[model samples]
Target: MKKIYIEIKWAFIYSITLLAWMLLENTLGWHQERIADQWWLTLLFIPFAVFIYLLAVREKRRRVYDRKMTWPQAFLSGAILSVFIALLTPISSYIINNYITPELFFNAMDYSTKNVGMTQSDANEYVLLTTYLWQSPIGALAFGLATAAIVALFVRKK
Candidate 1:
């Protein structure tokens, strides 16, 4: 528990950053009038995600491992951080979908059915809050682990 203090702290930071990004997207009209551009614009979050992972692993290496961390140590620390992020993703998603951008699903469904050729049923199934409730945590884990792996390689000292 003591050793993972850094990971826990970084996990909160990552979750806050994710929420901030969603707020930015909503403010930019991506959740409504600019829904068409939302998909690509959202992908821009990759850099922020990677940077957060890098910072997490680097902090763990510097603080927990005393600057002598190996690849495995960094990777484990990041994996733990990823787990924390995964655990928090549902709450973040709930807040974002329910509060920050309540109309996002409807807008996405509209775009999907009109421009992307998705049937209404398909769009409904794909774009709802329940769907995001499940997808968000899975996506967070998958992306977080992948980011952790790559970031571990770079942050590892020896």
Candidate 2:
């Protein structure tokens, strides 16, 4: 169960870091002023991805697997982290969207309409769909698991 604990700890760290990063970005108006225009912000995922991989693999290699880890073990650790992230995302999403910077939601809608060529109605629907569906728990789970599977491939020690 130590491995499970490690995965959970890392997951919590990663999730919190993600929330902080998002909050900082939004607070700085990056999401509002620059995100749509600057495609490079999307590359931020690469660092987070590498961080997740390193945390999972390094912990496995150091503590649980003891210098060597199998692919299945690496995958399992990543999956456990994913599940935790999936579980926590909803609460984080709610807090961030509701309390931290609710304006981003509306800003997103406007950006969608103006830049993405979406009509007002379509933008509204898109926001509703993304908020209720794509950013929801199920969507988090799906994305988390997919990320875990891919990260595990590189994280596996042997």
Candidate 3:
């Protein structure tokens, strides 16, 4: 419980930072909620990245790689961390979509459609794909591995 509390606190801190960044960078500055909408996409990385970062280090230093946790263990915990993002992302999305300024979504969608050199259908498809793709297991693996590797380099077991 102590270990988990430590790990999650860092991840949540980074996640909140990212969220604040999204609010400031996308909607407030450029008035680009569509791009900002995608910012929530990072919610996927926050928990997985931080936890795997710490866990991989601990696992390696303790010489427990031989007893490595199955991917299921890493992934299940990652999913739990992301749940925070999932809950907050949609509510944030709603506030941006409905309250802050409705035109931002339309503007972003329009900009994406025109600049991508794709038809409306394709652009819409891209948006949908990009939105959910970050949360997939593949994304988790990619981020988790990269983060874990870096943290592992510095890990020292107790």
Best-fitting candidate, scored by lDDT:
1
Q: Write the per-residue lDDT of candidate 1 for residues 36-127, one digit (tens) a residue.
A: 99889999999998998898888777777788888889889889999999999999988998899888888899999999999999999988
Please identify which of the two predictions, 1 or 2, would achieve the higher lDDT against the true structure: 1
**lDDT for each residue of candidate 3 in 64-121, tens digit (9 for 90 to 100):** 3334544444444444444444444555555544655455546666777776577787
Arrange candidates, best TM-score first. 1, 2, 3
Encode model 2's per-residue lDDT on 1-158: one tens digit a residue.
75488877876787678778778777767677875753466457557755775676577667877767776777777777777877777777777778766777687788888889999988887778355634566765676677767766776665
* Candidate 1 C-alpha error for residue 44, in Å: 1.0
Total clashing pairs for each candidate: 0, 0, 0
lDDT of each: 0.90, 0.71, 0.50
Candidate 3 wrong stretches, greater than 4 Å: 31-105, 129-141
TM-score of 3: 0.50
lDDT of 2 at 5: 85
Candidate 3: lDDT over CA atoms? Answer: 0.50
In Å, residue 50's CA in model 3 sits off its true spot by 8.1
